[model samples]
Target: MSTVFWAIVVLGALIFVHELGHFLVARMMGVRVLVFSLGFGPRIAGWSRGAGETEYRLSLIPLGGYVKMLGENEEEDEEKDQSGHPVVVADAPDSFANQGVWSRIAIVFAGPAFNFLFALMVLVMAFMLGVGELLPVVGSVSRGMPAEQAGLRVGDRVVAINEQPVTRWEVLSQTIKRSEGVPLRFTVERPEGPILLTIQPRVQEMTNIFGETVRTWLVGIGPGSGTEFVTYGFFSALVKGVEHAWRMTDMIVTGVWKIITRSIPADQIGGPLMIAEMAGKTAEQGASSMLFFMALISINLGILNLLPIPVLDGGHLLFFLIEAVKGSPLSEQVRLQANRAGMFLLIVLMAWAMKNDLTRIFSDG
Candidate 1:
């Protein structure tokens, strides 16, 4: 029950922020927003400021949300009344379709932009409040692995990898992963003083978060069972936050590329159930962990929405770009067909992810 609650809260907050971005930007562009909803399906609870104004709603479904704008679904046409006679509506000037191409582009892009910025802000707060991280000390080396073969021992503190300094296990792991089986020089601090060891990372297949098998470089060294709380000054935290967000973005992009190349299976994709379980587990770990997880999810959502696929923010931007180039929008028929295809693809993907989630649950049970 707690897990369900946290999952809803986390997802709700992210979705609200995303929709808020669109709502604010659309308003700025003089678009009349018809509805601001926090979820899909029938409205469960809501309030309206006045007749014909935006209706704020909390819907039945908590998995997703949307902001509906006036004329968002209508192509520019002669205004008509219920009798099909030409007439002007009171807020026709505020129609989204009547806005300039650039304005529409900005409104569409704002959702993803806000998600990324929210991640940065959350990261900064987490850093300022202090978060625990594993130190760069070797706890154990797996037998017959690259680390052991290179004579790495317990208590040896890794100082650098190939002349690049590493003070944390996270940085060390990233460095190893990027080595791509290349030989590396490890500078370590031992009781006998500093020592250099040459090691070549082994290419190994590992299961990723989505349960998809992916190949990565590994040195078979594990961090000691010790953690250190790290806190940064205000300015340092801000800088670190930006760096953290960028690193996460790069990692996500690389993961997507690997998936596209079929280096990982599509079954690795997960849906809401997986997210709920993760949210629960992270919440149990404490406030810092929960906040960090939120930041990570925000970044993922931002990047996912920016993929150049129809029915997404990136697709809208693509349409705007083409319109700018051709001096007109695509025909209504083409746009409708493209959107239908995109929606179909999305539904199929969601069903597959749900299947994976259910499989995991049943197998675990």
Candidate 2:
């Protein structure tokens, strides 16, 4: 329940900000927005200002919200459809479609931009408070394992993996994971003296929570006092925040590439259920922790929306780029078809995620 509360709050806040970006910009440009809705479906509670706009609020739906401008859709009502053009509505306010191309572009891009800004803010907060970092230490070396066979001891602290100096546990883990089953030389400081150990991990096949089997290398040992915490001030935090954003963006691109390359199975995808579970766990940590998780998720949302698939911001951007090149927007019929195809793909992905979630819950670890 705590998780659900935090998740909803974060989701609602980010979504409200996203829609508000559009609403505020549209209003600033003198666009006559007929409706400004916070959420979709029937209006649960709402009030309309006589001169400004009709704001119809709605019941709680965690999906998303939108701002509707005058004559946004091509199919206008007969009475309202003064001009019978399929693309542009004649009575459309001169703000949205009427403004210069650049202004129009800014409004469309602002929503995602704000999301990234929000994430940066939260990350800055996290870094300022101090992030936990783990040191690389060998706690318990598995018997008959690579480390044991290579004569590594319990108190040996790993100083470097090959030529890579290890400061944090995460760096060590990533280096090892990337190496797969390859043998690597670890320089460790033992009680007696500094020693080098050649450890080769065995690839272990195991089922994930989603029931999908993945091959990962296993070195049987527990990480002992593996991490140390460090805090930063404003300047450092901002730098770290930017660095974190870059790393996450890289990961997202890599994940996408893996999916395209078929290296990552589509069945491993997750949806709302996985998000909720993550939210719950993060909430248990505290507000700051939950906020941190929320920021990361927001970044993912912002980037994912910009992918060049249909019905997404990226899809729209791609079309805009093409329009800029070809001298006009794609025809409505062609755009609509593309949207339908995107929707179909999105639904299938969601269903697969839900299935994976269920499998994980029922399975014994």
| Per-candidate count of clashing residue pairs (backbone under 3 Å) | 1, 5
Off by over 4 Å in 2: 27-30, 54-56, 74-93, 142-152, 158-167, 171-222
Error of 2 at 253 (Å): 2.3
How accurate locally is residue 49 in candidate 2, as Cα lDDT from 0 to 100?
Answer: 72
Deviation in Å, model 1, residue 298 alpha carbon: 1.5
Task: Please give the distance, in angstroms, between residue 352's alpha carbon in candidate 2 and its true position after superposition.
Answer: 3.2
Candidate 2 lDDT, 1-365, residue by residue in tens:
77677667777888877777777776777766666666667767777777445565654555777776664553642223437544455345543556555555566677778788888888888878776676788778778877788787887788898977988777777777788688998988877788888888877687754345888777666678755667889999999899887777677667767777787777667677778888889888765577688787878778777778887667767877777788787898999999999999878877888998888777834
Clashing pairs in 1: 210-268
lDDT for each residue of candidate 1 in 278-301, tens digit (9 for 90 to 100)? 999999998878888999899898
Cα lDDT for residue 81, model 2? 40
- Cα error, residue 98 of model 2, in Å, equals 1.9
- Best by the lDDT measure: 1
Full-model lDDT for every candidate: 0.89, 0.73
RMSD to true structure for each model, in Å: 3.9, 5.0
